[model samples]
Target: MEGHIVLKNVQKSFGPKQVLRGLSVSVKKGRSLVVIGGSGTGKSVMLKCILGIIRPDAGEIRVGGESCIGLKGKDRDAFLARFGMLFQGAALFDSLTVWENVAFGLIQGRGMARHAARDIAVEKLSQVGLSSDVAALYPAELSGGMQKRVGLARAIAADPEIIFFDEPTTGLDPIMADVINNLIVDCVKRLGATTISITHDMASARKIADDIAMIHKGQIIWQGEANKVNVSGNAYVDQFIHGRADGPIQMDVLKA
Candidate 1:
């Protein structure tokens, strides 16, 4: 059985501005792949394309040996049911309590009983080291780190076959960031899910990725094992990982 997710010659554009240009990558079953790139480099666009939130102008995307581009109606719902996402800002509902937020997919999307969904929500919260008490509070009541953990719990509530993490460690203190990273590794290992994450945070990437691919100006310029990123010998990768300003990668900043 082939369970690998593959993308080939993918392209997307918004009118005149092309976002993805023949971007290709693959992740094996039960492996973690992280995409690193600067802002507006189409990392999110590539992810959205895979999620079917955005349709690609061209190319192929295969998940578990089936095409996943431009799915509709029941097909789209079924395809989306196989994946989970943790957004960059937690993206929780301010009105809903934590448990309600976590169980939203189950009760709403799957039509599961609220009681059953709540139980699963509590269980997932435990997986991320959050207590049942925390599940009673709204998103606004929690600290930034706690809110992120809630997002993670909600992500795994459905026990998805594939999970996508978008900038998981952004905006947290270093210690909290490490905490989230450890939780992500533990949870993913326990579930044995194939994962795709988009971020420029090398620390989080190093902690979570089996493979790392760098995107630049709508293309994957370099890719390799996470352990070998330091010695990739590509100047762009070198400049990025080291956080250097004086490198081949130029920012589109206006003169101040």
Candidate 2:
């Protein structure tokens, strides 16, 4: 598929445990794919593999038809320049001011002048509904929602071709989470970037996803358009979306 990021038969392992097993999925160009799954289902591992943070032990990962595995030095840096990520905790730098944090990649990675980078950062912050004054504040000075907004702004600061959002709405109140979800949808629409987001929040998924895929035990069990997730009929999908305790999907937790 044109402009698609495709993963085929990818696998990864840690110690005696296997994390990803033959995981495969395609995220079409300029569309959002939200992955849903229980904890320990290898969703994060799969995302890392795609981002080149964690290399897969086997199989293929292609970004726009070019294989991305084992990339090095300038190649890896250039490849990474195509991506922006919003981490689960917002993951802002406590020491840097908001705008500096937003411009980190442009300044450090691309060697852009600080003045130029700061202007771009301020612009991106405005896109996320933050004012220029907020740019001067440090991450620790902001509330959770504000911090997430800064994270979102930073993610789009470089206008990346692909963006990854890891549990974007986690750690926020319901209203704040919804606000963040709306911003995410709006930002992605404006950027027209291909995105892959992983979250347990079904409401966020419904609001932001074009396609939804479910991961279980390091494998994709079901995949379809966002609207069709309700009717997926897969036991695990149904259980997860409804958040039911008694279902085919059992917890791996050891009972006390």
Best by lDDT: 2
Q: How far is candidate 1 from the true structure (C-alpha RMSD, Å)?
A: 1.3
Q: Give the TM-score of candidate 1.
A: 0.97
Task: Write down the RMSD of all candidates, one decimal each.
Answer: 1.3, 1.1
- Estimate, for each residue in 1-256, the C-alpha lDDT of model 1 and write its tens digit: 5438999999999999999999988889999999999999999899899999899999999999999997999999999999989999999999999999999999999999999999999999998988999988999999999999999998999999999999999999999999999999998998899999998889999999999999999999998889999999999999999999889999977987
Badly placed stretches (over 4 Å) of model 2 are 254-256
Error of 2 at 226 (Å): 0.5
* Model 2, TM vs. native: 0.97
What C-alpha lDDT values do all the predictions have?
A: 0.93, 0.94
